[model samples]
Target: MAKNTTKNTEGQAPKGVRKPPATRKTAAQKKAEAEAKLKQQQLETGEGDNTPTDTPEQPNNEPTGETAEKEVTAGASESSAGQEGKTTETDKIKSDANPPVGNSTIEDLSDDEFDKGKRDGVSDDVEDQELMEGQMKLEDDGSTKIGDNPMLTDTKDKEEVQPFVRKTKIEKTSSNVSIKSLFKEWKKDQALRAKYRQEAEEAIKSGLPAPEFEDETTLRFDLAIQRNETWTDYQKSDLIHTVLYGYYLQPVLVEDSNDGKKWFIDGKQRLTTLMTFIEGQWALSKKTKPVYGYKIAGFKFNDLPSEMQDEIMDETITLVRIKNMTVAERDEMFVKQNSGTPLSKIELIRAMHSELSEQIDIELSSLKFFKEDLELTKKAKDKFIDVELILQIAMLIEEGKDRIKGLGADNYKEYVLRLKETEQIFSDEMIEKISNISNYLTLAFEDYEMDEVKKALKKVNVPIIFWTAITAMDDNLQPKLFGDFIRSFLISGYSVESAYGKSSQAGSSKKENVLIRLDEMSAALSQFIDMIRNASSIEEGVEQFNKHLADVNGVDREEGEDGERESA
Candidate 1:
């Protein structure tokens, strides 16, 4: 080689020459440095005297200083090289503190512990070196890691994270009154009022007995009688306009009570509208027509002009009087008066004034479960469907589910008629049974949080469940068992297919379907009740029932396939 001397920079290495890597401090060197730094800090703080002069006593057979360091280094090197057969002293301490969870059999661990371990971090079977590496990465970079685990950061939107808000239940009102009948009755009363006014004039001239119409004011409503219908906002507003615009208003039909009270038999809607308006209880609708060249919409009684107010207050409402009317007769007349436009069957049933109807209206309909928990639709409640359901349950109890075919219109009507004709009431036992069943159902639904079941519950399912509970359930059968049975039977796929599915598909009201459903459900409930009664605990009973149900479903599937093949 040619003689060539290269001059390098003061601190730089020669070009094309590699620099040596920095040497790692040995364990003893690191310990000595740490002790020296601690001594320096203590001396600066004037607390060096308290420093211990002797090393803390080590446990027997435990390695210390150089021997321990050499063993740890060798173990680490082996682990890093993928030899996991030997455990180091550090690993032994960790194993003592948190026993190797993976080495323990699954049956040895409690459900809660196992689940917590899974949620807390990685499995213990993972190599100790790898876990340390992960922990080191986490400590060094201030980031979470678990052996290349995927991040589970929340990706939900604000709306998804917000607490759920339940939909408001529909408003229920019994205000589907018949305006057509009111108009027809108004026309007939107009003719009668004209005839009566002529007669009153003649009677004043010839000194004869004359018909008299009561003032629109001073009229009273009898609270004893349940009016079959109520006026809608539109009907009340239209009546207000009719009176304000000088149209003739219908006369109220009243029955003279022995106590001298004018019991309203008909025209309640019209009379109430006018009277309520005069009392300033309500205002005119925004859609009210203009009157006397003035916009009257949103006007209360006091808002009307002086003359118009006087006209409304001074208007004569002919009171058609009858005497000695029984409650049934009164209800019948009320129904017939509104016959031009029919009321709902349940509404008609409510108007029957039967003991059963009274019980359903005054007692059953007022139940917390029936009113709030059942959460019937607006139309259903407006039409007295709750009342109807109570009656249906009562009927099932009294007539025996086998005897009753369906809960059709005719069946309910007949039931109400029979109760009226025979002057009978639902037995105390029957009423209590119905109430108990309803309360039980409410509690069951709530305890299990079975919102879906409640929403999908149809009218047809009511009687079947009621009958099943009545026939199969008893004091020995716990409420939990009952709830579980009901929830499973109503919602579980296999139970639905085997019992409620086919019958509820169509013609649920048919006698055969009703009986079949009744039979199937009754059998299932009976078996469940027996199972719960014989079992030690409700949970055990439920588990056994579920297993039995699964087995039954398997058999049913096999039989179904066989049947299909034969049919083909």
Candidate 2:
């Protein structure tokens, strides 16, 4: 007999804070629940939640807040996936045993006490202005104050530091790049998103497909490495490892197609990681096995991200090499900004490199050629590039708005264009920004202090890689692109899938197979790395990633579930 579900109506909805208000926890999805919760909490409020181990949705979204909640959240008892009963100390997750997740905040965050004291995180000043521009009420001096609007309090009470601006007006260019185009071109996920996956359960009940062999592309990411202002050694290693093994190593369609419906071309990193993971490298010391089982049936350290490994097992690895896509695809994937945070990291780096080449000839300051490369880079590249790295630099240099390091209402981008002229801010060029950055990275790795809040450098092994990949690009005034990253990554997962159930498909080849999303975990990680390391705009990067995530799972978020504060 089925038991009845009851609801109390006096004033409360339920004893617990259930997002979707459903109860179906599996060995893996259950864990995803906790991960999902942590990711969301971190995003909704720019800090790790440190709720008691028993409550998944309550506090300290900090990466190292409490393993008790992550490991013991109602359904974690099924497997011992390194999910110990309790432990959320300042130390990394488990370096030698599992390459720790996050550490406490005690090390340098690259800013002195005076600087840190003056900032909480970046203010949404620009975002608020964009939202309330014509509608804003001003004082006699034409300045907006916190007392004017209550909503502005979120940006002000936080004590965020407003960044200095020095950019001229943004030259407007015309294009058909709609919001949808921003997130275009990835592997074609023709499958019936969550519905098809959910049907696996029914398929099994009908005695058709097996549990372990369902669509392996279903992915789930670790919340351990998600952070912004601060990071620890474990967090850094996890970031690099997650990228190397998960997304870069997974099997994906890399090539582009004529029709918008199809996805082609997979990333190179996806191929390399699979070789080491699934193939088992038996001849080498690692001695990898060539067998496949439940998500991560036979791989080593399978617990961490076995779900994605399973997806790789299901698909055939094919290389899609195209020097330059045909006219249209090239326009879409290579240079398109279909998504908010599209290819900012890569395109921006290339843009930065391109801009530095000319070095803004002081003698030619009167010539338009001086900043032509920088300007054109923005127009030519997709919005995706802008969202990631470029956006981060904006947050860091400006008001720390991108990273949430300063306070105020969001006027960042406008401020940059109006006052922070690009040349004047960075000596017309910011030199020596990278050399010693490597030294700090090495120090972080060798017995370093940590941030429990931001989980700074917790998983890094190659800090220089992050420094160059993320920084070393065009300078935009903003703050904490890192915080944006944390919030967006989680929002992507939440918006994509909230309730887990059987696929609605009637007769899928994957019928009877337990729908799992392990494969996409790597993709998520890859996109995250590619975004953080290469995107041109933080807003663009988040949008693109979220869209790609939706494509992978067939679950889209409402328009405002998560977005750049341009509209506030």
* Candidate with best lDDT: 1
lDDT of 1: 0.62
lDDT of every model, 2 decimals: 0.62, 0.34
Model 1 lDDT per residue over 239-264, tens place: 87887677865656776665654557
Q: Name the weakest run of 10 consecutive residues (lDDT summed) in model 1.
A: 559-568
Q: Ten residues in a row with the worst lDDT in model 2?
A: 220-229
lDDT of 2 by residue, 436-548 (tens): 33233333233322222123221111121233323322232122443343334333333323221122122211212112211222234457657655668766776777666
Off by over 4 Å in 2: 1-265, 268-270, 281-296, 299-319, 325-428, 433-568
Q: After superposition, how far is residue 62 of candidate 1 from its true place, in Å?
A: 99
Q: Which stretches of candidate 1 lie over 4 Å from their true place?
A: 1-230, 275-286, 298-310, 377-379, 446-453, 492-499, 530-537, 543-568
